[model samples]
Target: MEPGTVRPGGRTARVRAAVLEAAGDVLAEQGFAHLDLAEVARRAEVGKTTLYRRWGTVTALVTDLLEDMAEQSVPRTETGALLGDLTANARLVRRTLTDARQGPLFKAVIAAATCDERTAAALRRFYEVRIEEWEPCARQAVERGEIPAGTDTREVIRAVSAPLYYRFLLDGGLLDDEAAVRAAGAACAAAKAGAFTTDTARPRSSDR
Candidate 1:
Protein backbone atom coordinates (compact mmCIF):
# COMPACT_ATOMS: atom_id res chain seq x y z
CA MET A 1 0.00 0.00 0.00
CA GLU A 2 1.12 3.54 -0.67
CA PRO A 3 2.00 5.60 2.40
CA GLY A 4 -1.26 7.51 2.22
CA THR A 5 -3.35 4.75 0.63
CA VAL A 6 -5.27 2.32 2.83
CA ARG A 7 -4.93 -1.45 2.37
CA PRO A 8 -7.79 -3.09 0.45
CA GLY A 9 -9.56 -4.50 3.50
CA GLY A 10 -9.05 -1.40 5.61
CA ARG A 11 -10.12 1.06 2.87
CA THR A 12 -13.15 -0.96 1.86
CA ALA A 13 -14.27 -1.36 5.44
CA ARG A 14 -13.86 2.34 6.18
CA VAL A 15 -15.70 3.38 3.03
CA ARG A 16 -18.52 0.98 3.79
CA ALA A 17 -18.85 2.30 7.32
CA ALA A 18 -18.93 5.88 6.13
CA VAL A 19 -21.56 5.09 3.55
CA LEU A 20 -23.75 3.27 6.04
CA GLU A 21 -23.50 6.10 8.55
CA ALA A 22 -24.52 8.52 5.84
CA ALA A 23 -27.31 6.25 4.68
CA GLY A 24 -28.64 5.90 8.20
CA ASP A 25 -28.67 9.65 8.62
CA VAL A 26 -30.45 10.10 5.30
CA LEU A 27 -33.03 7.47 6.14
CA ALA A 28 -33.63 8.93 9.56
CA GLU A 29 -33.95 12.49 8.30
CA GLN A 30 -35.72 12.01 4.98
CA GLY A 31 -37.08 8.43 5.07
CA PHE A 32 -36.21 5.71 2.58
CA ALA A 33 -38.48 7.07 -0.13
CA HIS A 34 -36.35 10.19 -0.28
CA LEU A 35 -32.95 8.49 -0.20
CA ASP A 36 -30.62 9.56 -3.03
CA LEU A 37 -27.27 8.12 -4.01
CA ALA A 38 -25.80 11.48 -4.89
CA GLU A 39 -26.79 12.94 -1.51
CA VAL A 40 -25.40 9.93 0.30
CA ALA A 41 -22.11 10.24 -1.53
CA ARG A 42 -21.94 13.92 -0.64
CA ARG A 43 -22.63 13.18 3.03
CA ALA A 44 -20.09 10.37 3.12
CA GLU A 45 -17.47 12.57 1.42
CA VAL A 46 -16.84 9.93 -1.23
CA GLY A 47 -17.18 10.38 -4.97
CA LYS A 48 -20.56 9.49 -6.47
CA THR A 49 -18.74 7.33 -9.03
CA THR A 50 -17.06 5.39 -6.25
CA LEU A 51 -20.34 4.81 -4.42
CA TYR A 52 -22.07 3.70 -7.59
CA ARG A 53 -19.18 1.45 -8.59
CA ARG A 54 -19.11 -0.20 -5.18
CA TRP A 55 -22.89 -0.56 -4.75
CA GLY A 56 -24.69 -0.66 -8.07
CA THR A 57 -28.18 0.35 -6.99
CA VAL A 58 -30.18 1.92 -4.21
CA THR A 59 -31.14 -1.55 -3.03
CA ALA A 60 -27.48 -2.53 -2.99
CA LEU A 61 -26.61 0.51 -0.91
CA VAL A 62 -29.31 -0.32 1.63
CA THR A 63 -28.18 -3.92 1.64
CA ASP A 64 -24.64 -2.88 2.43
CA LEU A 65 -25.93 -0.66 5.23
CA LEU A 66 -27.81 -3.53 6.80
CA GLU A 67 -24.75 -5.76 6.58
CA ASP A 68 -22.66 -3.06 8.22
CA MET A 69 -25.19 -2.63 11.00
CA ALA A 70 -25.05 -6.32 11.75
CA GLU A 71 -21.26 -6.33 11.76
CA GLN A 72 -21.15 -3.37 14.15
CA SER A 73 -23.45 -4.86 16.78
CA VAL A 74 -21.94 -5.99 20.07
CA PRO A 75 -21.47 -9.70 20.71
CA ARG A 76 -23.19 -11.58 23.52
CA THR A 77 -21.54 -12.25 26.88
CA GLU A 78 -21.41 -15.48 28.89
CA THR A 79 -22.75 -15.32 32.44
CA GLY A 80 -22.27 -19.00 33.37
CA ALA A 81 -26.02 -19.65 32.99
CA LEU A 82 -28.57 -19.67 30.22
CA LEU A 83 -31.00 -17.20 31.76
CA GLY A 84 -28.33 -14.65 32.60
CA ASP A 85 -26.77 -14.75 29.15
CA LEU A 86 -30.21 -14.53 27.56
CA THR A 87 -31.18 -11.63 29.78
CA ALA A 88 -28.10 -9.72 28.71
CA ASN A 89 -28.80 -10.48 25.07
CA ALA A 90 -32.37 -9.29 25.45
CA ARG A 91 -31.27 -6.06 27.07
CA LEU A 92 -28.78 -5.32 24.31
CA VAL A 93 -31.35 -5.95 21.59
CA ARG A 94 -34.02 -3.98 23.42
CA ARG A 95 -31.74 -1.03 23.85
CA THR A 96 -31.03 -0.88 20.12
CA LEU A 97 -34.62 -1.39 18.99
CA THR A 98 -35.88 1.24 21.41
CA ASP A 99 -33.40 3.95 20.62
CA ALA A 100 -35.00 7.13 19.24
CA ARG A 101 -32.89 7.36 16.10
CA GLN A 102 -32.07 3.69 15.57
CA GLY A 103 -35.68 2.57 16.00
CA PRO A 104 -36.98 4.72 13.17
CA LEU A 105 -33.96 3.91 11.04
CA PHE A 106 -34.60 0.19 11.41
CA LYS A 107 -38.26 0.64 10.60
CA ALA A 108 -37.35 2.36 7.36
CA VAL A 109 -34.81 -0.32 6.41
CA ILE A 110 -37.25 -3.15 7.16
CA ALA A 111 -39.98 -1.52 5.13
CA ALA A 112 -37.59 -1.12 2.21
CA ALA A 113 -36.48 -4.75 2.54
CA THR A 114 -40.04 -5.96 2.26
CA CYS A 115 -40.19 -4.74 -1.34
CA ASP A 116 -36.60 -5.22 -2.50
CA GLU A 117 -35.14 -8.69 -2.99
CA ARG A 118 -31.55 -7.57 -2.59
CA THR A 119 -32.42 -5.63 0.53
CA ALA A 120 -34.36 -8.59 1.88
CA ALA A 121 -31.38 -10.90 1.39
CA ALA A 122 -29.21 -8.40 3.21
CA LEU A 123 -31.70 -8.21 6.06
CA ARG A 124 -31.69 -11.98 6.37
CA ARG A 125 -27.89 -11.98 6.44
CA PHE A 126 -28.02 -9.39 9.19
CA TYR A 127 -30.27 -11.63 11.30
CA GLU A 128 -28.00 -14.59 10.56
CA VAL A 129 -25.02 -12.70 11.96
CA ARG A 130 -26.90 -11.75 15.11
CA ILE A 131 -28.12 -15.31 15.54
CA GLU A 132 -24.58 -16.61 15.20
CA GLU A 133 -23.39 -14.13 17.79
CA TRP A 134 -25.75 -15.49 20.46
CA GLU A 135 -25.75 -19.13 19.40
CA PRO A 136 -22.60 -19.79 21.40
CA CYS A 137 -24.29 -18.77 24.63
CA ALA A 138 -26.94 -21.42 24.12
CA ARG A 139 -24.28 -23.92 23.05
CA GLN A 140 -22.37 -23.21 26.22
CA ALA A 141 -25.48 -23.88 28.31
CA VAL A 142 -25.91 -27.25 26.66
CA GLU A 143 -22.23 -28.08 27.21
CA ARG A 144 -22.60 -27.14 30.86
CA GLY A 145 -25.72 -29.33 31.25
CA GLU A 146 -28.00 -26.37 31.86
CA ILE A 147 -30.08 -27.24 28.82
CA PRO A 148 -30.60 -30.35 26.68
CA ALA A 149 -27.56 -31.40 24.68
CA GLY A 150 -29.44 -31.12 21.40
CA THR A 151 -31.02 -27.76 22.00
CA ASP A 152 -31.39 -25.58 18.92
CA THR A 153 -29.10 -22.66 19.65
CA ARG A 154 -30.38 -20.62 16.72
CA GLU A 155 -34.00 -21.03 17.72
CA VAL A 156 -33.31 -20.15 21.33
CA ILE A 157 -31.50 -16.97 20.37
CA ARG A 158 -34.23 -16.11 17.89
CA ALA A 159 -36.88 -16.70 20.53
CA VAL A 160 -35.25 -14.18 22.83
CA SER A 161 -35.57 -11.42 20.21
CA ALA A 162 -38.68 -12.42 18.25
CA PRO A 163 -41.16 -11.05 20.73
CA LEU A 164 -39.09 -7.97 21.26
CA TYR A 165 -39.04 -7.21 17.52
CA TYR A 166 -42.74 -8.02 17.21
CA ARG A 167 -43.57 -5.62 19.98
CA PHE A 168 -41.44 -2.91 18.47
CA LEU A 169 -42.56 -3.27 14.84
CA LEU A 170 -46.08 -4.65 15.04
CA ASP A 171 -47.76 -4.19 18.42
CA GLY A 172 -46.19 -0.87 19.43
CA GLY A 173 -45.63 -2.15 22.93
CA LEU A 174 -43.08 -0.53 25.22
CA LEU A 175 -39.55 -1.82 24.73
CA ASP A 176 -37.80 -1.62 28.06
CA ASP A 177 -35.58 -3.46 30.50
CA GLU A 178 -38.65 -5.07 32.03
CA ALA A 179 -39.75 -6.32 28.63
CA ALA A 180 -36.24 -7.69 28.07
CA VAL A 181 -36.38 -9.58 31.36
CA ARG A 182 -39.77 -11.06 30.43
CA ALA A 183 -38.49 -12.17 27.01
CA ALA A 184 -35.38 -13.73 28.56
CA GLY A 185 -37.50 -15.58 31.12
CA ALA A 186 -39.83 -16.95 28.45
CA ALA A 187 -36.92 -18.13 26.27
CA CYS A 188 -35.14 -19.69 29.23
CA ALA A 189 -38.20 -21.62 30.41
CA ALA A 190 -38.84 -22.92 26.91
CA ALA A 191 -35.21 -23.91 26.47
CA LYS A 192 -35.16 -25.68 29.81
CA ALA A 193 -38.28 -27.64 28.91
CA GLY A 194 -36.60 -28.97 25.78
CA ALA A 195 -38.80 -26.88 23.51
CA PHE A 196 -35.74 -26.03 21.43
CA THR A 197 -34.07 -29.42 21.61
CA THR A 198 -35.20 -30.97 18.35
CA ASP A 199 -34.49 -30.00 14.79
CA THR A 200 -37.47 -29.80 12.39
CA ALA A 201 -39.79 -29.28 15.36
CA ARG A 202 -41.65 -26.20 16.40
CA PRO A 203 -41.29 -24.69 19.83
CA ARG A 204 -43.74 -26.34 22.23
CA SER A 205 -47.16 -24.68 22.09
CA SER A 206 -47.06 -24.44 25.86
CA ASP A 207 -44.17 -22.00 25.50
CA ARG A 208 -46.44 -19.55 23.79
Candidate 2:
Protein backbone atom coordinates (compact mmCIF):
# COMPACT_ATOMS: atom_id res chain seq x y z
CA MET A 1 0.00 0.00 0.00
CA GLU A 2 1.16 3.54 -0.83
CA PRO A 3 1.66 6.04 1.98
CA GLY A 4 -0.45 8.59 0.10
CA THR A 5 -3.52 6.36 0.02
CA VAL A 6 -5.88 6.98 2.91
CA ARG A 7 -7.21 3.94 4.74
CA PRO A 8 -10.67 3.36 6.17
CA GLY A 9 -9.56 4.01 9.72
CA GLY A 10 -6.53 5.92 10.93
CA ARG A 11 -3.83 4.93 8.45
CA THR A 12 -1.09 6.99 10.08
CA ALA A 13 -1.84 5.51 13.48
CA ARG A 14 -1.71 1.96 12.11
CA VAL A 15 1.64 2.56 10.43
CA ARG A 16 3.00 4.04 13.65
CA ALA A 17 1.72 1.07 15.64
CA ALA A 18 3.33 -1.42 13.28
CA VAL A 19 6.62 0.46 13.14
CA LEU A 20 6.85 0.75 16.90
CA GLU A 21 6.14 -2.93 17.41
CA ALA A 22 8.88 -3.86 14.97
CA ALA A 23 11.25 -1.37 16.58
CA GLY A 24 10.58 -2.88 19.99
CA ASP A 25 11.25 -6.39 18.73
CA VAL A 26 14.58 -5.33 17.23
CA LEU A 27 15.53 -3.41 20.32
CA ALA A 28 14.73 -6.33 22.58
CA GLU A 29 16.46 -8.97 20.52
CA GLN A 30 19.25 -6.99 18.81
CA GLY A 31 19.66 -3.77 20.85
CA PHE A 32 19.83 -0.16 19.62
CA ALA A 33 22.84 -0.55 17.31
CA HIS A 34 20.87 -2.96 15.16
CA LEU A 35 17.73 -0.85 14.88
CA ASP A 36 18.10 0.79 11.48
CA LEU A 37 15.11 2.29 9.64
CA ALA A 38 15.39 0.08 6.57
CA GLU A 39 15.61 -3.03 8.70
CA VAL A 40 12.71 -1.98 10.94
CA ALA A 41 10.61 -1.17 7.89
CA ARG A 42 11.40 -4.57 6.41
CA ARG A 43 10.48 -6.30 9.66
CA ALA A 44 7.33 -4.25 10.01
CA GLU A 45 6.44 -4.95 6.35
CA VAL A 46 6.32 -1.17 5.81
CA GLY A 47 7.96 1.07 3.29
CA LYS A 48 11.40 2.35 4.30
CA THR A 49 10.48 5.72 2.82
CA THR A 50 7.46 5.90 5.07
CA LEU A 51 9.50 5.22 8.24
CA TYR A 52 12.25 7.66 7.24
CA ARG A 53 9.76 10.29 6.24
CA ARG A 54 7.88 9.93 9.49
CA TRP A 55 10.56 9.33 12.12
CA GLY A 56 13.71 10.61 10.33
CA THR A 57 16.01 9.02 12.91
CA VAL A 58 16.34 6.11 15.32
CA THR A 59 16.34 8.43 18.34
CA ALA A 60 13.04 9.91 17.29
CA LEU A 61 11.61 6.46 16.88
CA VAL A 62 12.72 5.45 20.36
CA THR A 63 11.43 8.67 21.87
CA ASP A 64 8.06 8.15 20.22
CA LEU A 65 7.96 4.57 21.52
CA LEU A 66 8.57 5.80 25.06
CA GLU A 67 5.81 8.36 24.72
CA ASP A 68 3.43 5.71 23.44
CA MET A 69 4.37 3.41 26.31
CA ALA A 70 3.68 6.17 28.81
CA GLU A 71 0.33 6.83 27.23
CA GLN A 72 -0.69 3.16 27.08
CA SER A 73 0.56 2.26 30.56
CA VAL A 74 -1.86 0.83 33.07
CA PRO A 75 -3.67 3.14 35.44
CA ARG A 76 -3.09 2.87 39.16
CA THR A 77 -5.27 0.66 41.34
CA GLU A 78 -6.76 1.84 44.64
CA THR A 79 -6.79 -0.79 47.37
CA GLY A 80 -7.95 1.45 50.24
CA ALA A 81 -4.85 0.69 52.32
CA LEU A 82 -1.59 2.41 51.52
CA LEU A 83 0.20 -0.90 51.81
CA GLY A 84 -2.23 -2.45 49.40
CA ASP A 85 -1.74 0.36 46.92
CA LEU A 86 2.03 0.16 47.24
CA THR A 87 1.97 -3.61 46.98
CA ALA A 88 0.03 -3.36 43.76
CA ASN A 89 2.53 -0.86 42.38
CA ALA A 90 5.53 -2.94 43.41
CA ARG A 91 4.10 -6.13 41.99
CA LEU A 92 3.43 -4.48 38.66
CA VAL A 93 7.01 -3.26 38.42
CA ARG A 94 8.34 -6.64 39.42
CA ARG A 95 6.21 -8.39 36.84
CA THR A 96 7.36 -6.10 34.04
CA LEU A 97 11.00 -6.45 35.03
CA THR A 98 10.60 -10.20 35.03
CA ASP A 99 8.68 -10.53 31.80
CA ALA A 100 10.48 -12.60 29.17
CA ARG A 101 9.98 -10.11 26.33
CA GLN A 102 9.42 -6.86 28.16
CA GLY A 103 12.40 -7.32 30.50
CA PRO A 104 14.84 -7.34 27.60
CA LEU A 105 13.15 -4.38 25.96
CA PHE A 106 13.35 -2.33 29.15
CA LYS A 107 16.97 -3.27 29.73
CA ALA A 108 17.90 -2.34 26.18
CA VAL A 109 16.14 1.03 26.40
CA ILE A 110 17.85 1.84 29.71
CA ALA A 111 21.25 0.89 28.33
CA ALA A 112 20.70 3.02 25.26
CA ALA A 113 19.67 5.96 27.44
CA THR A 114 23.07 5.93 29.14
CA CYS A 115 24.86 6.83 25.90
CA ASP A 116 22.20 8.84 24.07
CA GLU A 117 21.12 12.20 25.44
CA ARG A 118 17.79 12.17 23.60
CA THR A 119 17.02 8.66 24.83
CA ALA A 120 18.01 9.59 28.36
CA ALA A 121 15.69 12.58 28.38
CA ALA A 122 12.90 10.44 27.00
CA LEU A 123 13.58 7.78 29.63
CA ARG A 124 13.35 10.40 32.37
CA ARG A 125 10.04 11.62 31.02
CA PHE A 126 8.73 8.08 30.89
CA TYR A 127 9.58 7.54 34.56
CA GLU A 128 8.07 10.89 35.47
CA VAL A 129 4.84 9.87 33.75
CA ARG A 130 4.82 6.57 35.61
CA ILE A 131 5.58 8.30 38.89
CA GLU A 132 2.78 10.80 38.32
CA GLU A 133 0.38 7.92 37.78
CA TRP A 134 1.17 6.33 41.15
CA GLU A 135 1.90 9.42 43.23
CA PRO A 136 -1.80 9.98 43.80
CA CYS A 137 -1.79 6.87 45.96
CA ALA A 138 0.48 8.63 48.38
CA ARG A 139 -1.70 11.72 48.25
CA GLN A 140 -4.74 9.66 49.11
CA ALA A 141 -2.84 8.11 52.01
CA VAL A 142 -2.12 11.59 53.34
CA GLU A 143 -5.84 12.44 53.25
CA ARG A 144 -6.60 9.23 55.14
CA GLY A 145 -3.95 10.06 57.77
CA GLU A 146 -1.91 7.04 56.74
CA ILE A 147 0.96 9.36 55.96
CA PRO A 148 2.00 12.91 56.77
CA ALA A 149 0.39 15.93 55.08
CA GLY A 150 3.67 17.18 53.64
CA THR A 151 4.79 13.89 52.23
CA ASP A 152 6.62 13.78 48.94
CA THR A 153 4.19 11.68 46.97
CA ARG A 154 6.53 11.15 44.04
CA GLU A 155 9.32 10.01 46.31
CA VAL A 156 7.05 7.54 48.01
CA ILE A 157 6.09 6.13 44.63
CA ARG A 158 9.75 5.90 43.62
CA ALA A 159 10.57 4.08 46.84
CA VAL A 160 8.23 1.28 45.82
CA SER A 161 10.13 0.61 42.57
CA ALA A 162 13.72 1.57 43.42
CA PRO A 163 14.70 -1.76 44.93
CA LEU A 164 13.18 -3.69 42.07
CA TYR A 165 14.99 -1.60 39.46
CA TYR A 166 18.19 -1.89 41.44
CA ARG A 167 17.98 -5.65 41.19
CA PHE A 168 16.73 -5.66 37.62
CA LEU A 169 19.45 -3.32 36.36
CA LEU A 170 22.40 -3.78 38.67
CA ASP A 171 22.23 -6.37 41.40
CA GLY A 172 21.14 -9.22 39.08
CA GLY A 173 19.32 -10.64 42.07
CA LEU A 174 15.93 -12.29 42.17
CA LEU A 175 12.87 -10.13 41.63
CA ASP A 176 10.43 -12.44 43.31
CA ASP A 177 7.13 -11.90 45.06
CA GLU A 178 9.05 -11.68 48.33
CA ALA A 179 11.09 -8.79 46.98
CA ALA A 180 7.97 -7.01 45.76
CA VAL A 181 6.21 -7.42 49.09
CA ARG A 182 9.29 -6.27 51.00
CA ALA A 183 9.66 -3.21 48.84
CA ALA A 184 6.05 -2.16 49.39
CA GLY A 185 6.23 -2.89 53.13
CA ALA A 186 9.43 -0.88 53.57
CA ALA A 187 8.12 2.06 51.57
CA CYS A 188 4.84 2.05 53.47
CA ALA A 189 6.64 1.90 56.82
CA ALA A 190 8.88 4.79 55.81
CA ALA A 191 5.89 6.82 54.69
CA LYS A 192 4.17 6.16 58.01
CA ALA A 193 7.34 7.19 59.87
CA GLY A 194 7.48 10.51 58.05
CA ALA A 195 10.55 9.57 56.05
CA PHE A 196 9.00 10.96 52.89
CA THR A 197 7.76 14.20 54.40
CA THR A 198 9.03 17.56 53.14
CA ASP A 199 10.01 18.54 56.69
CA THR A 200 12.04 15.34 57.25
CA ALA A 201 15.41 16.25 58.71
CA ARG A 202 18.54 16.04 56.65
CA PRO A 203 21.90 15.30 58.20
CA ARG A 204 24.54 18.05 58.14
CA SER A 205 27.07 17.85 55.32
CA SER A 206 29.89 17.42 57.83
CA ASP A 207 28.02 14.50 59.42
CA ARG A 208 27.95 12.57 56.15
Candidate 3:
Protein backbone atom coordinates (compact mmCIF):
# COMPACT_ATOMS: atom_id res chain seq x y z
CA MET A 1 0.00 0.00 0.00
CA GLU A 2 1.08 3.61 -0.61
CA PRO A 3 2.02 6.02 2.19
CA GLY A 4 -0.96 7.50 4.13
CA THR A 5 -3.22 5.11 2.26
CA VAL A 6 -5.75 5.29 5.09
CA ARG A 7 -6.01 1.52 5.30
CA PRO A 8 -9.35 -0.20 5.88
CA GLY A 9 -11.07 1.10 9.05
CA GLY A 10 -8.52 3.88 9.57
CA ARG A 11 -9.04 7.33 11.05
CA THR A 12 -11.93 8.32 8.80
CA ALA A 13 -13.81 5.15 9.56
CA ARG A 14 -12.96 5.43 13.24
CA VAL A 15 -14.26 9.00 13.37
CA ARG A 16 -17.52 7.98 11.71
CA ALA A 17 -17.89 5.06 14.07
CA ALA A 18 -17.26 7.16 17.12
CA VAL A 19 -19.65 9.87 15.96
CA LEU A 20 -22.42 7.39 15.20
CA GLU A 21 -21.94 5.65 18.52
CA ALA A 22 -22.19 8.95 20.33
CA ALA A 23 -25.28 9.82 18.35
CA GLY A 24 -26.91 6.53 19.28
CA ASP A 25 -26.12 7.03 22.94
CA VAL A 26 -27.67 10.48 22.84
CA LEU A 27 -30.76 9.24 21.07
CA ALA A 28 -31.17 6.34 23.48
CA GLU A 29 -30.69 8.43 26.56
CA GLN A 30 -32.17 11.82 25.64
CA GLY A 31 -34.26 11.19 22.52
CA PHE A 32 -34.22 12.91 19.11
CA ALA A 33 -35.31 16.29 20.37
CA HIS A 34 -32.15 16.64 22.35
CA LEU A 35 -29.66 15.35 19.80
CA ASP A 36 -27.37 18.32 19.38
CA LEU A 37 -24.52 18.11 16.93
CA ALA A 38 -22.18 19.98 19.26
CA GLU A 39 -23.04 17.62 22.07
CA VAL A 40 -22.44 14.67 19.81
CA ALA A 41 -19.05 16.04 18.81
CA ARG A 42 -18.20 16.58 22.44
CA ARG A 43 -19.23 13.08 23.33
CA ALA A 44 -17.37 11.53 20.42
CA GLU A 45 -14.27 13.63 21.07
CA VAL A 46 -14.46 14.88 17.52
CA GLY A 47 -14.33 18.46 16.37
CA LYS A 48 -17.68 20.21 15.87
CA THR A 49 -16.49 21.37 12.46
CA THR A 50 -15.97 17.80 11.35
CA LEU A 51 -19.48 16.81 12.36
CA TYR A 52 -20.95 19.83 10.58
CA ARG A 53 -18.88 19.28 7.46
CA ARG A 54 -19.67 15.59 7.32
CA TRP A 55 -23.36 15.31 8.23
CA GLY A 56 -24.51 18.93 7.84
CA THR A 57 -27.81 18.41 9.63
CA VAL A 58 -29.41 16.32 12.36
CA THR A 59 -31.77 14.63 9.93
CA ALA A 60 -28.94 13.61 7.64
CA LEU A 61 -26.96 12.20 10.52
CA VAL A 62 -30.00 10.33 11.77
CA THR A 63 -30.67 8.95 8.31
CA ASP A 64 -27.10 7.74 8.04
CA LEU A 65 -27.37 6.17 11.49
CA LEU A 66 -30.48 4.30 10.45
CA GLU A 67 -28.80 3.07 7.29
CA ASP A 68 -25.79 1.91 9.27
CA MET A 69 -28.06 0.14 11.73
CA ALA A 70 -29.80 -1.74 8.92
CA GLU A 71 -26.49 -2.74 7.43
CA GLN A 72 -25.19 -3.95 10.79
CA SER A 73 -28.37 -5.77 11.81
CA VAL A 74 -28.12 -9.47 12.46
CA PRO A 75 -28.79 -11.84 9.59
CA ARG A 76 -31.94 -13.97 9.66
CA THR A 77 -31.82 -17.48 11.04
CA GLU A 78 -32.92 -20.36 8.84
CA THR A 79 -34.72 -23.16 10.68
CA GLY A 80 -36.36 -25.05 7.80
CA ALA A 81 -39.76 -24.80 9.48
CA LEU A 82 -41.85 -21.65 9.18
CA LEU A 83 -42.76 -21.45 12.86
CA GLY A 84 -39.21 -22.05 13.91
CA ASP A 85 -37.87 -19.43 11.55
CA LEU A 86 -40.49 -16.90 12.58
CA THR A 87 -39.91 -17.61 16.26
CA ALA A 88 -36.23 -16.94 15.78
CA ASN A 89 -37.05 -13.69 14.03
CA ALA A 90 -39.47 -12.69 16.75
CA ARG A 91 -36.91 -13.46 19.43
CA LEU A 92 -34.36 -11.33 17.64
CA VAL A 93 -36.78 -8.43 17.45
CA ARG A 94 -37.74 -8.86 21.08
CA ARG A 95 -34.13 -8.85 22.11
CA THR A 96 -33.50 -5.64 20.16
CA LEU A 97 -36.57 -3.91 21.55
CA THR A 98 -35.79 -4.97 25.07
CA ASP A 99 -32.12 -4.11 24.99
CA ALA A 100 -31.05 -1.24 27.25
CA ARG A 101 -29.58 0.90 24.48
CA GLN A 102 -31.26 -0.44 21.33
CA GLY A 103 -34.71 -0.29 22.85
CA PRO A 104 -34.63 3.41 23.64
CA LEU A 105 -32.74 4.18 20.45
CA PHE A 106 -35.53 2.58 18.40
CA LYS A 107 -38.18 4.46 20.33
CA ALA A 108 -36.40 7.73 19.68
CA VAL A 109 -36.09 7.08 15.98
CA ILE A 110 -39.72 5.95 15.77
CA ALA A 111 -40.88 9.06 17.55
CA ALA A 112 -38.78 11.22 15.24
CA ALA A 113 -40.17 9.44 12.21
CA THR A 114 -43.72 10.17 13.28
CA CYS A 115 -43.20 13.86 12.59
CA ASP A 116 -40.27 13.98 10.24
CA GLU A 117 -40.77 12.92 6.65
CA ARG A 118 -37.11 12.19 6.02
CA THR A 119 -36.84 10.15 9.19
CA ALA A 120 -40.05 8.30 8.26
CA ALA A 121 -38.65 7.45 4.85
CA ALA A 122 -35.42 6.26 6.42
CA LEU A 123 -37.33 4.18 8.94
CA ARG A 124 -39.43 2.67 6.16
CA ARG A 125 -36.31 1.79 4.22
CA PHE A 126 -34.77 0.24 7.32
CA TYR A 127 -37.78 -2.03 7.79
CA GLU A 128 -37.85 -2.81 4.09
CA VAL A 129 -34.29 -4.07 4.30
CA ARG A 130 -35.09 -6.09 7.41
CA ILE A 131 -38.24 -7.54 5.85
CA GLU A 132 -36.39 -8.49 2.70
CA GLU A 133 -33.76 -10.25 4.78
CA TRP A 134 -36.44 -12.36 6.52
CA GLU A 135 -38.80 -12.77 3.57
CA PRO A 136 -36.97 -15.90 2.47
CA CYS A 137 -38.19 -17.70 5.56
CA ALA A 138 -41.74 -17.38 4.32
CA ARG A 139 -40.67 -18.23 0.79
CA GLN A 140 -38.98 -21.36 2.02
CA ALA A 141 -42.15 -22.28 3.88
CA VAL A 142 -44.05 -21.94 0.62
CA GLU A 143 -41.57 -24.20 -1.11
CA ARG A 144 -42.02 -26.68 1.72
CA GLY A 145 -45.84 -26.55 1.28
CA GLU A 146 -46.21 -25.06 4.75
CA ILE A 147 -48.28 -22.17 3.46
CA PRO A 148 -50.64 -21.49 0.56
CA ALA A 149 -49.11 -20.99 -2.86
CA GLY A 150 -50.15 -17.37 -3.23
CA THR A 151 -49.35 -16.37 0.27
CA ASP A 152 -47.95 -12.84 0.67
CA THR A 153 -44.63 -13.67 2.26
CA ARG A 154 -43.98 -10.10 3.25
CA GLU A 155 -47.20 -10.00 5.21
CA VAL A 156 -46.26 -13.17 7.02
CA ILE A 157 -42.95 -11.66 8.00
CA ARG A 158 -44.63 -8.43 9.07
CA ALA A 159 -47.21 -10.32 11.10
CA VAL A 160 -44.49 -11.99 13.13
CA SER A 161 -43.07 -8.63 14.18
CA ALA A 162 -46.24 -6.49 14.42
CA PRO A 163 -47.46 -7.78 17.74
CA LEU A 164 -44.03 -7.42 19.23
CA TYR A 165 -43.88 -3.83 18.01
CA TYR A 166 -47.34 -3.18 19.40
CA ARG A 167 -46.23 -4.33 22.80
CA PHE A 168 -43.03 -2.35 22.52
CA LEU A 169 -44.70 0.81 21.30
CA LEU A 170 -48.32 0.83 22.41
CA ASP A 171 -49.82 -1.94 24.50
CA GLY A 172 -47.39 -1.85 27.42
CA GLY A 173 -47.86 -5.59 27.58
CA LEU A 174 -45.21 -7.99 28.77
CA LEU A 175 -42.52 -8.29 26.14
CA ASP A 176 -41.16 -11.56 27.36
CA ASP A 177 -39.70 -14.48 25.45
CA GLU A 178 -43.10 -16.19 25.62
CA ALA A 179 -44.58 -13.13 23.94
CA ALA A 180 -42.10 -13.58 21.11
CA VAL A 181 -43.04 -17.25 20.77
CA ARG A 182 -46.73 -16.37 20.81
CA ALA A 183 -46.25 -13.73 18.16
CA ALA A 184 -44.45 -16.18 15.93
CA GLY A 185 -47.08 -18.86 16.57
CA ALA A 186 -49.94 -16.52 15.72
CA ALA A 187 -48.34 -15.37 12.49
CA CYS A 188 -47.47 -18.93 11.59
CA ALA A 189 -51.02 -20.06 12.26
CA ALA A 190 -52.38 -17.24 10.17
CA ALA A 191 -50.04 -18.08 7.34
CA LYS A 192 -50.90 -21.77 7.45
CA ALA A 193 -54.61 -20.83 7.38
CA GLY A 194 -54.04 -18.69 4.30
CA ALA A 195 -54.95 -15.46 6.04
CA PHE A 196 -52.07 -13.72 4.25
CA THR A 197 -52.90 -15.08 0.81
CA THR A 198 -52.83 -12.44 -1.90
CA ASP A 199 -56.44 -13.23 -2.75
CA THR A 200 -57.47 -12.59 0.86
CA ALA A 201 -55.51 -9.44 1.31
CA ARG A 202 -57.38 -6.19 1.66
CA PRO A 203 -57.65 -4.19 -1.53
CA ARG A 204 -55.82 -0.95 -1.98
CA SER A 205 -57.71 2.35 -1.80
CA SER A 206 -57.24 2.84 -5.54
CA ASP A 207 -58.71 -0.57 -6.23
CA ARG A 208 -61.72 0.30 -4.09
Model 2 RMSD, rounded to 1 decimal: 4.9
**Clash list (residue pairs), candidate 3:** none
Ranked candidates, highest TM-score first = 3, 2, 1
Residue runs of model 1 more than 4 Å from their true location after superposition:
1-13, 199-208
* C-alpha TM-scores of all predictions: 0.87, 0.91, 0.91
lDDT (10s digit) by residue, model 1, range 94-154:
9998887888888888888888876788889999999999999999998998888778889
The predicted structure with the larger TM-score, 1 or 2, is: 2
What are the per-residue Cα lDDT tens digits for candidate 3 across 1-208? 2111222377988988898899999999999999999999999999999888788889888888888899899999998899999999999999999999999999999999999998899899999999999999999999999998889999999999999999999999989999999999999999998889885564556877
- Assess candidate 2 and give its lDDT: 0.88
TM-score of 3: 0.91
* lDDT at position 190, candidate 1: 96
Model 3: residues >4 Å from true position, as ranges?
A: 1-9, 200-208
lDDT scores of the candidates, listed in order: 0.85, 0.88, 0.91
